[model samples]
Target: MSCRTVASFISLFLATTAAVQAQTELGNFSNVARGGVATTFVTDFQAIGINPANLGRNDNARVAFTIGEVGVGVGSQALTRTQLRKFIEDSGEELNMAQKQEMARTFTSDNVLNLNVDATPVAFSVVLPMVGSFAFSSRQRVTTHLGLNKNTAELLWLGKDAPIYPANFNPATAPLVSEVLEGTSIQMAAYNEYNLAYGRQVLSLPAFVLSVGAGYRYIQGVGVVDVRSKDGQLEAYSALSPQFNVDYGSVVNNPSFNLQKDTDKLLQPVGRGHGYDVGIAAEVGKKLRLGASVTDIGQMTWEGNLLTANDQKLKRLRSNGADSYEFFSELADIFASGTDSLFQYKPAQERKASLPTKFRAGAGIRVGSRLEVGADVTMPLNDVAGNIPAAFYGVALDVKPLSWIRLSTGVTSGAGYGMGIPVGFAIATKVYELGFGTRDLRGLLSDERPYASVAMGTLRFKIGTVK
Candidate 1:
């Protein structure tokens, strides 16, 4: 393809950013609650797929069971839960022009909103005196992004009743813009993974104990959607439904970019692969611990029901409108393509993808019998197709006033966003444990909308024995 085509392709691809089941490499919120500090603080099956060496440190009995664990965190700068309720649940309430205007004012050219979720329905683990420790679990992870541009926002605030696009929108005289406007992306994806971990003591000394281990993981990619653009003639495409509607928006001069997609079917294992995690941990004396690891060094090949979307034809847009909120709203749809459009999509045979490889290290200190503190840092080593998580750093403190009760809180940042205060608690006994927490405590503390936010594992439950 030509340079322009390649540019168009790159812009569109990067704009489409979301996961069907988005989760940071740290995985769930319980992990987040403890500030996602992974170099330490692990003592059970929770260590699997994280730092395998941690498996050998579960001072509990020989076996453990996990009934279920699911977490979700969704935050946005573009809209609030109240606003979303007004739009989706308040059936009797209709949006007024002022409300629409207020909503439109929230979006900008450099904005990002997203959601991440991770879950483990069931799992099991065991420790053998001489054989080390072993465990197995399953997980679902997803990430999604919401984006908006200047032109798209204008369309939603004003209607196409009059020509808003004059040859030269003189900024000095009129409250208008002349440049090719930017657009938004409603991109997403989710996938599943099966993981097995084993840990064994590798070294013993007068003042230190060291362990090493690894995790074998199998991944099944169930869903994917890539749609976006950085520059060129402004345009947008949407398929509201598979068999019905399709919509398109473009400037009068440029080719109308279009897309037709039935992405629902792709939300299954259209691709599969295997990877591994290797790690080592050391206990210095009895109050301090340290660990390091690397993970997801593998690739996946998507061969089933492969497809692509493209808009090559030139087409006419509806009545030219400089600012129409309805037009922009209709322009950014994630599912259900509209009825008519210049964009078209076709099924391809196959594709190859690399896993999101990662490197992490951490350390923890036991301040006393009742309080423990730790810190961890993780970085994505590769730009895996479905995983673009940012490097993260965190520090967490856990307090156990009673054997059956645990409280934790910490500060963390990265994974592509701002800093967060995470806090949560756990109620546990020999037979079961229940815990909850959030990585995006900013959403709870601030009244103004945050740039990026998250909430998950607040309602996590696991009915398993420490024995």
Candidate 2:
């Protein structure tokens, strides 16, 4: 192919691959609080998601069980818990102008909103001596992204009744406060993943040990939504919910989404695809180690509960009646309202999508007997279907004070998510282990909080005869 054709092909490949870059709920709370440090010392089943090559770290424990694993990241700086809670509590009531303005002030054309949920439903892994380590896990990864354009904010606070939208309301100069900004994007995805993996020593030397691994993943695409725009034009596609109805609004410039229905079959994944992960790790003279890996190099074909909404070029839109706080279900109805209203809701045709592939390079060093430190840089190869995640680099330290107690802490910042200090400890015995940590540990000590994250898991259990 010609060079121009190759460039076009590469662009198309990226556009497609960007749709699947998703969330952080894959590793355990320990990994979550350690600034995403799995590329270094991950020695258990968690390695399946972190670095399959770590599976080669090898242990005599032979078995591990992961339970109630959950992680949440609210990647937005516009609002806080108190504000979000207050908004929810008042969603059912009418909002006065002041309240509307307050909400609008928190939103901006450059504002980014993302919601991530990573839960491991069931997981287990085992070492088979020279046969390598084998593993499988069912995980749920969901992410939602929204870029609030100035116009959208206007629709929120001023409604379609704003004088700016009136036919004769043109002004000589753009309003200094609300200049016409570039259009924003809104995308969401939820899917269930079943991963099967194997990793073992691929090479060995007198002074170093090298391992290579690969994984096969089955993806059940539950739902996906993508609304991308440039300048002021937009186009949207949806499968985010298994099924739904959109009662599009008729108000000029005022579009509201009213999503309804679907109690029977949302869990049955609407789309299906498969992909794989491959990695390599080398331990240099027992104390220094290096590794690299690429994961989620796969695709899902969305075929069920699909919908699309092209921008309406709306001149008027519905107002404050949508956003709410007191209840969750009704709030969803208002949230999904006619935002995609003007577009005809059709049986979305099946389309192919790629997962957000990620690349990681990491290093670690063991300083003495009980203290170990590591760092890693992880970045998505392309923008995913939802929000664009920032590349991150952070360092972590793991210290063991006693055979049964381990302490870990780290700091991370990048991808516009801000900085977070993770401090946690793990208590492990020969047959059982308990681990807990928080990505926002600093929040507990000061009001100058940077991010809001929750990391906790109690059902984590492990059985081994090794110390």
Against the true structure, whose TM-score is highest? Answer: 2
- Score every model by TM-score: 0.72, 0.80
The segments of candidate 1 whose C-alpha lies over 4 angstroms from its true place after superposition are 1-29, 58-61, 78-81, 84-105, 109-111, 149-186, 228-268, 310-343, 450-467
* Clash tally for model 1: 36
List residue ranges in candidate 2 displaced over 4 A.
1-24, 88-94, 109-112, 162-183, 231-233, 240-266, 318-345, 386-388, 443-450, 459-467
Window of ten residues with lowest summed lDDT in model 1: 1-10
How well does candidate 1 match the true structure in TM-score terms?
A: 0.72
lDDT of 2 by residue, 1-467 (tens): 01121112222222322332222444477787686776877766787766788777644347777776766655465656565435423436655667666666666635345556677877788887668787788887766665666655555455644444666643343332213324555566777888888888887786898988888888888666665566555555555442323232342122332232357764766678897898998898879989899988888887654555444434333444234332222213212333413233344466677788888889999888688899988887866673236687788888989978888888776655566677877886667767767665664444332345566666766676322
Tell me the RMSD of model 2 versus the true structure: 9.0
Which lDDT tens digits does candidate 1 get at residues 227-289? 554444322221121222122233112233223345656334656788898989899997999
